[model samples]
Target: MFSTFARIRTLYSSTTFTNNTSIFRCIKTIAPSIDQCSNPFSGKGSCGRSVPNDDYFATIHHVSNIVRRDIYLERTLNKMHISRIVNSELVYRVLRSCCQHGIESFRFFNWARTQHPQYDPTTVEFEELLKTLARTAHWETMWKVVQQMKAQNIPISPSIVSFIIEHYGKRGLIDQAVELFNRLKNFGCSQTTEVYNAMLFALCEVKNFQGAYALIRRMIRKGTVPDKLTYSILVNGWCSAGKMREAQEFLEEMSRKGFNPPVRGRDLLIDGLLSAGYLESAKGLVRKMTKEGFVPDVGTFNSLAEAVCKTGEIDFCIDLFNDVCRLGLCPDTETYKIVITAAAKAGRIDEAFQILHRSIEAGHRPFPSLYAPILKAFFRRGQFDDAFSFFSDMKVKGHPPNRPLYTMLIKMCCRGGRFVEASNYLVEMTELNLLPMSRSFDTVTDGLKNCGKHDLAKRIEQLEISVKGI
Candidate 1:
């Protein structure tokens, strides 16, 4: 039996059957007796059926043909005509493979329907295709597929309905989503909480707070109790729309209904308050959250610190950082980055360096953007030696100097009339394949020529041309 399978596999490998007739003939030749294996078409197998020694060979043959058919469809989709008839089972496997390739699924779907009028896709196959369309945001194609299903009287499942609703809602097609939800029965689906929640989420995502509230009333009228997730969705929607008053009212209503509004709701409210410049209110909420046994995470604190820093309350930012440490919550790289940015902006170079060093000790590899602020501060203060040393350290730590840093150094050197140093940095920039701005190169080249270094200026010009060609 094993020898038979090996020979068949070799035959398939050796032959390239472009048309379905040849492939089908090959399949028929290798197929074992019906009594030898479980019936592939019966959808059931009787117990104690006699097993054939060549059943494995038949199974391998089916799998190999399926793979070959898939490859043929993928490569010859544009040119090959489906003239030869294939079984529904093979067509189903080909459809599934097409779904995995995204948009090509639609092409194959259209081709399959036209080519094999007798082979109607099952519910599972349609569902998989719809899921693929939704995931890829092929909205128009999805609607067309849905229409085809309707015309064929195919039963649409609740999961498929939910996927369409959720995607339509996310794409801001709220009316279409709602219409689909209302027509659930037409599609032979029973309305459930999952469907209702999907609709509610869609409304919330589009900031249709009034529509969401009305939908909640409708849910109650239908005797469908709104779940905790339903209320949280509304609260988040209101908060995101900057309607803190309404958001808080919804939170109170959630509590009255014997549901503790989740931490996400409170976080959204806090974020909204901070964004609206209600710093005092935002801080009060943080305190309230802690008292309610819900400690704010590092991200929440970092947001507050950033907002406080923007208001020039550097002291308060420092106090918040100290509080984060006292609570035994280890500061993340973002937390340190925010503090460093604030310190650098305030010209507190020593404090910025201290924080940066601490971040490095805590295993955070510094980004070049993080170094920008302090580097600019050092350059402004005329601390040339300190700036060069910092640049050396950055390179040693595996961050070679980037274009902006080189540009800064070149501009500073030009301003100070350090033509020799500027020319050396220009060469290094070229060596690192980092191109400075054309204006910076022109400025340095002209400065060197004016300083009587004609040879070096000519070389710099040549380097600029070579780098540009690359």
Candidate 2:
């Protein structure tokens, strides 16, 4: 909801902002009244005379844990190290404070870094701050830190080493992140799960199928059993790669390894198959679940039915409805909706009527969603009378049609040259607060245009524009 552009522009434009002012601005913006804390750092006594590094860290450990921005501000105010406060401590405190709270601290920390450009970049403490800032998604600050670090000796943590790589990896910085990975490797810190997951996720991100697969193999060899999350990543990556076969195989392998993959796995496979126009194949996968010693529950059927209908398989879904009855599985509301959708799509008016009748006989109460298919079914058959009748039924059931249902019915009425009925729904759209979208309005306007009703169209256009302002 926030614009990073505004913040970045503010950073680049500002000058003469010293660390104190920069930090104050940050605290003001992020910590909000951090200066008002009763325990504010009385900078004089907060710092000590010629303090050793370990003692400093030990004494301030409690301070470091202070998550309240007000407390941090109080500490910041009083804890100016007399020994020329190192850049690392500066960055780390700001970062630790932010991490304890949120990314809001970046504003203060970011302002702090830029205001002091002439500060030694190679100072070990400075490098630590830069790395922490980057880890918190501060890319603008990260690059500045990296350039300065390269210009001198700044020892980045092995964790920051990996984090820097990932920062680049996410923004498609594969080559640069790899270079940093190599640099960190020379320091004897090997790739860990976070490292591999970062690379795998990155490669999977841009569909670098071959590279991600190679990393998967490397991860397994290093004794990293792919977590359920990892498997899900691989599945989606495989689908994006147009290698459904591999996704299916990977799912089987995960199952064999005793990873009771989430129902989402089945969802992915069925959805992928349906999208590829493999309705029969999708059904086969669903059927196979039962044979694999996992009982196909209502959810399983619902997912497959929805997938089948979504992929434009109306007849197949209708057949599934009858088949489900024979299998003694009582269809739920979702199942009925799926079957009705298929009937509507296939324009099987008689079949849709039969299904609707059967749903009533079988005690399936109609919901608003059920109207999507039934309304579409009537519209497909050019039955404006029947469509309105069902629309009335929805109101009686205390489930008035929503925007989508309204749009569908309006389109049907307009296409069949029923401008009067279409206008009724346009008013209904306003009364229900379901502002018809641009496309929905277009459908109505087109109908009104054909019927030569400019005045009515203008009214709808006004409603649409007014809602956009809101």
Best by lDDT: 1
Tens-place lDDT digits, model 1, residues 1-470: 12322322332122221222232334334433433322333432321223232442343344434444565554454333322323344344555554545566666666666765554566666777898788678878887887888888898887778877888888898998988898888878987767888898899878888989888768877877666567656765776676888988876775676555444557657766775577888888877865565657677788888888888988668766665566665789889878888888888899889888878888888887777778777877878668767877877773567888788888887887876677667666655656668898899889989999887777677666655643
Runs off by more than 4 Å, candidate 2: 1-198, 204-228, 236-256, 264-312, 321-338, 350-369, 380-382, 403-470
Q: Compose the digit string of candidate 2's lDDT tens values, residues 371-390.
A: 57777767777777887787
Q: State, as a TM-score between 0 and 1, how close model 2 is to the true structure.
A: 0.46
Alpha carbon lDDT of each predicted model: 0.68, 0.60
TM-score of each: 0.55, 0.46
Scanning candidate 2 in windows of ten residues, the lowest lDDT window is: 17-26
C-alpha positional error of residue 136 in candidate 1 after TM-score superposition, expressed in Å: 17
lDDT of model number 2: 0.60
RMSD of each: 16.0, 15.9
Clashing pairs in 2: 26-108, 40-74, 41-74, 41-78, 43-78, 88-125, 88-126
Supply the TM-score for candidate 1: 0.55
Candidate 1 local lDDT, residue 2: 25
